[model samples]
Target chain A: MALRNASLSVNKGEILAIIGPSGAGKTTLLRLVNLLIQPTSGLILFNDVNTSGDDKHQRSLRRQMSLVLQYPALFDTTVFNNVALGLKIRGCPETVIKEKVDNMLAVVGLSGFEKRMVKTLSGGEAQRIALARALVTEPKLLLLDEPTSNLDPKNVSIIEDIVRAANTKSQVTVVLATHNLNQAKRLAQRVAFILDGEIVEEGASKEIFEQPKDERTATYVDGRMIY
Target chain B: MIYLGGWEEIGFGLFRALQLIFSGDPEVLRITLISLRVSGTATLLGAAIGIPVGASIALRRFPARTLLISVINTLMGLPPVVVGLFLYLMLSNFGPMGFLRLLYTPEAMVLAQLVLVAPITAGVTLSAVSNVDARLKEMAVSLGADPLQEVRIILREARLGLLTAVIVGFGSAISEVGAIMMVGGNLLGYTRALTTAIVLLTNQGAFTEAIALGIILLGLAFAINILLTYLQLRTKAGLFAAETERHHPVT
Candidate 1:
């Protein structure tokens, strides 16, 4: 996925929404920023430091960020175990893990779902559990790839509230990728329009949707056919 | 002993088979126990070695991986008699490492069956672990799991498939005849197992006794499969009452 001239900067403690149509490289951008995949040409900077490191270096950097995919790739286990896996890997104490997992589950409005098997959960419940797992780790940067795309309105609202709460309460930086223009407008402080693997326009959320400097951005924001 | 008409022979044999099973004939009991010990040991040993090896092979991406998998798959259908012959030569007095004189022993029988079962378990496990969703590993790595932890999670997700691998191995071990017969020599009250005993009884025209042993073998297979299936589903469904109650006490 060729990403060119996509030079984008995200300030700390703010939601930067990348809005684009399907196959427009939104997931790729998030993965690149998360450092899960290497960019062939561009440099990725996390916290103003060049992230050109070996595998060990990358893993340490990755521990500070969490990526929630469009579909929740939850493990086939109990909800508590799924939410507790990241902490367990970090070698957190059992008491601490239980405390944090419980808090996160409650945060996602899934209190007492600890023993419930993940296989028996509904889509919304599972996504909420996914959010719980991702947010439970308290990552410095939360990368969401269309988190609410497949969710019902109720789940969508709940998830949006959770993300907003995480940013507001923990001061977590967020890079959200979504195809829903309205969702981008609602959740993001800043919005960047991407098309064909290139960033067409970027500005404050209010400004970009209203007066996109690029023709493609304007066309997409107006819900028109853009080639 | 005299040969009888076909339908009446089958009828008499079946009646006597049931009689032997219910009456617990000493010879039948001894043969059944020997069969169980030999096959059970082989299956256990096979599972112990095969599961981890198979899981590790499935996770790796070495150059010889495809070739190794192909070899294992081919070995799954390895002829039992061939294994018996190979082991027979190896354990024979003139062959290398034959000084221990393990030929025609129950241990030799187990060795033969293990050869037959290990490949089956390993091949099935390889297929099972490979069939698990690839996204699971990505998720594990994303969540800070090192490579080892990634494998652990994959194995956990493929637990049912791994169990099936073991069950299939056990099935193979229990039903085998040619290899054990060749190496074990079908020694009465010694290495003679259900299949070998059935063969002996049939050859001697004790058809009813052979049929009895056949029914008992089928019964053993049925019982073991039912037990394993119960464990798999029960654990999966969280219905292990004792464990469940301890972990999740009623509120």
Candidate 2:
């Protein structure tokens, strides 16, 4: 019962934020979208194609998207290898991988840190590397689960700016799940408020946060407990 | 009936064994080298088969998986003598594999040890791969890793554990005497390994040679443990340093 009866649509190149309290199924929703976990029931269509099928099709669809987990699970390797993994999996040439990895690291403010071990990085640095790794492939869609959670203000700002740049410059569709209402307000073009495994309300970001149609959504956005 | 001379004989035997060790006695060295060769071959063969089977069992889900894992775990404790008996029957002249004429040879001993070692290797590898962070697989999938790449990534993360499996497998193979004794027949200058030689020398009342072989066996085990332990410690230290850096940022 992690997620149920939750229906929503995300336009291409749009930034959609899923904001809710803990255990509200925001992460579950993002996982569903990423096809990392399949819905027990319901159809998930990607570009008019159903994604729930054999592994080959799923893999093909997944290559066009990237999901960054909250904890940023980096491989036990160097930053360069971690960032280059997606491109490598796609069979990108060594020269192209090197160039793209370098560019991504630079964009994430980790220009000279390619050779450094991922385990040696601080939390902020590791999170940035995770973002760089996710964005390196220039995915058509980016799914972020609490990307800035537990980071200091500086790291949060850096991550938000990176997400913004990726969306605006690359036109990558983004579906970000976070508990921080303020972050939802700042970043998302549209917002969905989920509670108890269901989307309680959905609309434009400004209307959902400032003029929430549902009482539960209003309570959540107003900083009041709504369990 | 107190056998007061036994203590003096034991002391002298120890002295002679040390002398043989230091003097590079060819006979003693040959026995030690044969022991390593037989056991090393078994271990390599075991790992080559065991690791992939173990990792696959850990990563996949199907009916009877629990039963298979239980069978593997139980086999890890398989008695060496039982393996020896089973192989003895299989490789004997009247048996199905009799045409190969492998019985009473080093090859027969290796086959017996492989039976004893493969399960241990696979069992340890199963535990190691299972202990890897589950989120790592999910992350790999989200990052677009295909099935093969996902396995490669998981195996890389679980390298230390896999090495531990090899060490355990090798240790079991090298230290086992019961199986090899039954199959090898301990032919001198040919099939005789350190453990079998020790047994033969003791039975023939050549206490000095037995003691020498025992000491060399102990030394071999000690050397291997020391090297593998060093590697394990170095890996642990690197991981610890990385963890420390992750938790404490230089701001």
Candidate 3:
């Protein structure tokens, strides 16, 4: 019941935003792409290869992407270990893990926080750490679910900047899900409007916001779409 | 008539036990050491088997999982005498495992205690693992951790709870007398542990020696409890600190 007949694709290095009201299945759609959950009946093709066969192949495909949850879900360890987890799992050497983790922390404005316990971090700080952890692996695709839903303006702006930098500089494909229309306009190249588990309209971000083809999309962009 | 001079007798017995303790009574020390060794080995074996079983049950979903959990929970409170009897039958001369000739030996006592302890350890560990946030597991998977890596991460996060399980298993194994006495036969200078020895001394009218053994058992239990409790408190404090900071961020 969460999502049905929802199909979309992303270009390499392009940012796609999924905008919708609460219960519109934006999070569910993102989770499906990340392979955290499977569709009851659908095919997900990664790099033109169907991702629904063979456990080993699925795992290999999964390793090429990362997902950041709406709320930060950090390990109960130091910040360094959190960011180094993916690399370690992939059998990266310790020296490389340390260097990459350190650089990623610095990029997220958390320099010198390698030894800080994750539990002691503030919400914004924790979310930033989650981002750093996700991006440290340099995944081919990064899916975020309302990455800035509850953050303050300053933290929100900082996160937006980080996501932009990751897409432009690292060429990581990004799919961000949020209800914030302005955020979609600012960061996403293409936008999809989801309502009740279906994509109502999909187009370039500027066109979607400026001249929406669907009446519901226009009402949603105008901030008048009721739950 | 038998109860005459009860208070004075107990006071004198207490003083005598203390003297015996300080003077290094070989029999008492030997009994205490044997108790520790048997129970300690059983606890280690129990944890080795129990933690993984518990974690697997918690993480995997299959048919009869609820039934398995219920069975484990029931076994956690298994009567010591019943376990002793069950193992006695299995290890008896006419039984299938009789070729090992482990009956009435220290190993048999250890086996009995292991049976008791393993279920307690597993049940407690199951509860602990179940308490972990489901989102954490999802996040780990989303961050590219394979199934094995995901399990390792979950176990690491639940380390404190696992430690508690081991401690509880040890406590259960160390405190029981009936099961060990039945399987070990409480052989003098061999399998006689603190609990069995205390019973022997008390029955033989050596109240002073019994009281001394009792004091040592209490002291051991108290020490282990205190250490584990301190550790639990520290872990809880760290979690609480994180929770507070998360909810109330500094400007």
Candidate 4:
């Protein structure tokens, strides 16, 4: 499939979910958005500014968006330090850093885990800390790569709630990639069904879940196990 | 030419050797001290140049990296005799560096060891830096750390391996003889070290004294190895504990 021909826009404060089988390029799409891997050919506009020329410009654009990997890539450091890292990079003042980290951690329901080591955290707890790490940067957009995959059902619900709340409270655009249809319906306003490196269908989450456009989307939403 | 084969004779010879060492025989004492000093200097100088060079290579991409690494690997295996002869030629009166008059001096011995050890140090340090977790670099860059900041992080994570590199370099320098003997002239009470002295005593039929010096050199090498092993183990344990204590299950 043509990699860069696909186009999808995430509006400010809108939660867009992309659901697909494994090897459908869902993670590749997120990686493209994160600029970790550039598309062979495509237009990626952040704030209507094309960031394809200089790597520095692309990095600057990246600062405006945070991508949370499926496995929370926390540092081998304390939770507080991990959450404070982005601010530290931006050279934020000490007092401001402390305040923002505390607020962010609290929002992610990890208020007292500041000094805790990353290795001791459970999968869900680590994911929450990862969320706080991303949110502390105050990015305009947050892209998640199956953030709830390793989480328990309870943690999954909590993560869904937190994503919804983040979109509402902070007006941050949320783009979640998952294979779980129920989560797509619960947390996303719009859903895009991808298959074989192509977006098969794109529409409102409710309509897409109830009335999938393509056979692949229908099979995927119907839980026929496309993967 | 001579035959004095007896247990009593052997005992007497060993006793005389010990007496020579303890009574502060200037020649023996001077050689031991010079060896240590030269080896120490070379190791330190090697570290000063090697670690940073290795770190830079590991962190950045440049043309000729493969060629550079191949050259370093080849240098790591360089023959001490060849190095000694090459330096001897370069520092002779007819050569450009002859005005410095460095040959047959402790400094010359040190310079030779530096050449021999620098490549080993750099190669080991490069491996250390390369083995550092890539996730750490990605994490640092993702946080907008500049190249310097990223390298600092790499160095911090690679401290133990760098220390090992220094220890190994020192071990290699201390045991080398050809370079020291050639450049140091193995001069009496001057630039002689354990290896050169052992060679000198053997050449002069001082078998008992040479054996004694050989024993001491072996002891020194063993001690250095033990100390370095302890240091390596301690650093690894410390890292393990630190990682566990601050363990973020992420990348």
Best by TM-score: 3
Give the per-residue lDDT digits (tens) of candidate 3, residues A125-156. 99999999899989999999999998999999
List candidate 3 stretches off by more than 4 Å: B1-18, B225-251
Per-residue alpha-carbon lDDT of candidate 4 for residues B1-251, written as tens digits (9 for 90 to 100): 56657554456557766777679887777778888899999999999988888877888789989888889889999999999999999888887899999988899999999999999999999999998888667766665555565576567668788888998899999999999899889887888899998888889888778777876777677887798888876654243223212212121
Q: Ten consecutive residues with minimal summed lDDT in candidate 3 chain A? A: A53-62
Tens-digit lDDT track for model 2 on B1-251?
56767676767777888898899999888888889999999999999988998999999999999999999999999999999988888889997888899999989989999999999999999999999899888888887777877887787678789889989998998889999999898888888999888888899999876776777788898898789888876664343123211111111
Please list all clashing residue pairs in model 3, or write none if there are none: none
CAPRI quality level assigned to candidate 2 from its DockQ score? acceptable
| Model 4 chain A: ten consecutive residues of lowest lDDT | A1-10
lDDT of 3: 0.87
State the TM-score for model 2: 0.91
Give the winner by DockQ: 1
lDDT of 4 at A45: 79
RMSD in Å for model 1? 4.6
Model 1 Cα lDDT, one tens digit per residue, B1-251: 66656766677778887898889889888989999999999999999988987998998889999899889989999999999889999999988859979998999999999999999999889989999888777787787666666676688778888889989999999999999999999998999999999899999998877777887899898899998888777666332112211121111
Best by lDDT: 2
Which lDDT values do the candidates have, in the order given? 0.86, 0.87, 0.87, 0.82
Docking quality category of candidate 4 according to DockQ thresholds: incorrect
Q: Compared with the true structure, what per-residue lDDT tens digits does model 4 show for residues A79-184?
A: 8878887776666777888899999988888999987888899999999988888888988989998999989999898888888888998899999999877888
lDDT of 4 at A129: 88
